[model samples]
Target: MLDLRSFLEVCKKEGELLELRDVDWDVELGTLTELLAEKGGPALLFDKFKDYPEGFRVATDMYTTVKRFALAIDMPPDTNGLEIIKKWRAVDFEPVKPVEVATGPVMENVDEGEDVNLLKFPVPRFHERDGGRYMGTGVAIIIRDPDEGWVNVGVQRVMLHDERTLGLYISPGKHNAIIREKYWSKGESCPVVMDFGPTPLLFLSAASHVAWGISEMEWAGYLAKEPLEVIAGKVTGLPVPANSEIAIEGEYLPPDVESRKEGPLGEWTGYYGGGERSEPVVHVKAVYHRDNPILAGTPPIKPPNYAFAVQVRTTPLLWNELEKAGIRGIRGVWEHGAGGGRMLTIISLKQEYGGHAMRAALTAAGSHAAGYMSKLVIVVDEDIDPTNTNEVLWAVVSRANFEDSVSIIKGCWGTRLDPALPPEKREKGDLTHSVMIINACRPFYWKDRFPPVNRASEELRKKVIEKWVNEIPLLRG
Candidate 1:
């Protein structure tokens, strides 16, 4: 099993890691996530922050690079994310139970009560306008099923409040939210473990909540192709990765009893929505970490950022799942850049009949974990690549006859994070929007063949490259 320590060793060997020393937390760390985004830079390691000692560090941008993405998926150097997704589709996963470890690096230090100071770590203020230092962007939160005796893990953001408390914003769609809701419903606090510096594989597995009754640690083993090693927590019964650099054990209290403002910073949607409603308060029970721990994070905002990479790798999985729904001839799918990867989806398919394309579009709109928020669904012919914006535009202009080709529906759908939606809809209540699907395929019911295209042949391209590559040295990487 690849533990957290071994994962860090691998990242170091790949020449993709950077260590930042004595960085200030108030604005320094937030600036770092942005600078790296601007440059498409490597992952960072902040060794020291404002009040923290030199030992604690924060790691960001680990999943920002393609190489890191390749590593997380266990693909070879030459393989891209699409190739990895194809492999994932072919494999039949077998869950491997975690191996219990008696001792590990995560136990090197244990702090409780007044000594538990979250500010002592290199927790970053991710954006200049953020509410406070956010310590939980890249962390995996662990929760247990009430009746099944199974542990579930998922990546969620947490806002650090003070030494003894934090603001937990568990999305209503995630397993952590359900677990916390169960606790709050009964007027009891839910025991939870937040692991900040676990293996990248843990975060990858945790990002997707497993089906009901499925253990996420076992799913981690399925992805790693080996068993994972976990250590039981000191206060919470949750099992954390044995080699994790930092683990915080806590409980989520009722929102009415404990709540506070959590954000006004850049969200994954790229806009700073005023801020999320006050979340429930978490009472920290214990903090455990290895010596010289590294805290990893990604300040979410806009396209080409952390959420984009996640959507690029994961949203495509929905395509495979849609095909299993008996939909056929799926060509390509793209979640547009605007929605922070959650709000918009565009698909190209070879439609078998009038409603096939619309069926595919709706499936992509309402699939699992998408939070029911698809702003627009555009469907085009198989000849077009959904990833190419120009092709999508061309299909829309050339084939969509507007009145005949566009299908618009209006009613209560999932429309979260859309500022344009009415206040009642943006709140817990559902919002209504005119959902349109532009059938950009040729009128095959009327015409037999599409207009021909003019392009270079594969043989001609190969001959041209063979002749000019050496002559034009700039053409070679």
Candidate 2:
């Protein structure tokens, strides 16, 4: 609850911290993380890398599991994905505003100008085909809107360009990109502070879409139920988390003067869609860190687990938007967990009128909070569990008239990282794409003629589980 360091301490106490000593940094450090993550391993804290000193360490898999993710937001360890987001949506965030601090752990050691060397930290080559060791994953890039004066924080993939420079991949619609353009339009270099490994919640809140103009720090305060501690950055003048593990303050040089080649790192979509390209460069002006800093490495490794916590935000966000839109009979909403909580979403509703299911589907697909990049949006009756793919699919195949139910709206907001996108269109910055909205709910005209579910009821299932408790191990949960 205090900082990333405090969260790691809690993880250590709960036996969620996996300490690995004296590992190789080149590819070995990241390889181990990927292998352990695939096996559903614990949070990794690597100390004494082959080329780095004992104090310079790296950590991975911070939110790889539900237990770890719940800890990130101070929730119960066993809280599932849907529950986590729902609880977050229920919090009363009444502008807890950031409290300024004199000094903290992140500023313990400071380097300015040519003295700043990013290579001091243990940057890892996360995958076998990676272009180089990256310093951007699991990091929060802090920038304030030049006009609005409100801050924007985004967790973007950063490439370590050199000893004094770094490159970042800011998606087209992200606030950071918009804010940077505002600075660039004035023909001035945009100052930024790269906040690294302060807190997992800090990263989560920063990366989320809280409403426009509201700072992510305010949202973090909402999650912590207390004002977040921030300090004036030494160079950038932006607010940096008081207890962050590392801070890299720099100016985003105009692309005309300098640019850095970035990419090929696997993104949260579990694929490398964009590949390599030239991106804006952040010339390092100052560096700050705690003594023997732990660089948090949250690179998107293989499929599935990396995006669980990332996707949780979307579930509640979409649900709340629907309620705000005055759409009634909304029973539940779920982002298919295995889809990394991004592409596939399902909405369950009690059909109150004709076209209700299609209406819900269209609303979800067009949502700004959670609709972007959604590949398939399925709407089902309240009887179906949106979180359960098997139930949703059964409803789809059984209830839907294939030709009438499927609706594809072309040029809808999409992501550049979508692997299915054509290379030429991606290069041209055409992020919009078609989304398939499927209404799997039973036809309103059928009324009482609709076929009843053949499966046993939940009461009967619970009764069976209670009666056969001794014989069925899987039913214990």
Top candidate on lDDT is: 2
Choose the strongest candidate by TM-score: 2
Model 1 per-residue lDDT tens digits across residues 327-400: 89988777666656666667788878767877887766566634245667788889898878788988889887
Model 1: which ten-residue window has the lowest total lDDT?
A: 410-419
Which residue pairs in model 1 clash with each other? 30-126, 59-295
* Candidate 2 local lDDT, 1-477, one digit each (tens): 468878888899999999989888788888888888888889999898777778888889888888998988888787787678777674455666888999888889999997989998888888877888889788998899988889888888889888998997887777888889988888899999898776777788877767678787888887888877888987888888888899888999878878878888877788887688788899999988999898888888655766677577778778877877767888888888666776788999999899887877888887856776888999999988887879999999999998988888898877777889987888788878888988899988785699888889999999999999889888898
Alpha-carbon TM-score of each model against the true structure = 0.89, 0.94
Ten residues in sequence with the least summed lDDT for candidate 2: 87-96
TM-score of 2: 0.94
Per-model tally of clashing residue pairs: 2, 0
RMSD of each: 3.2, 2.3
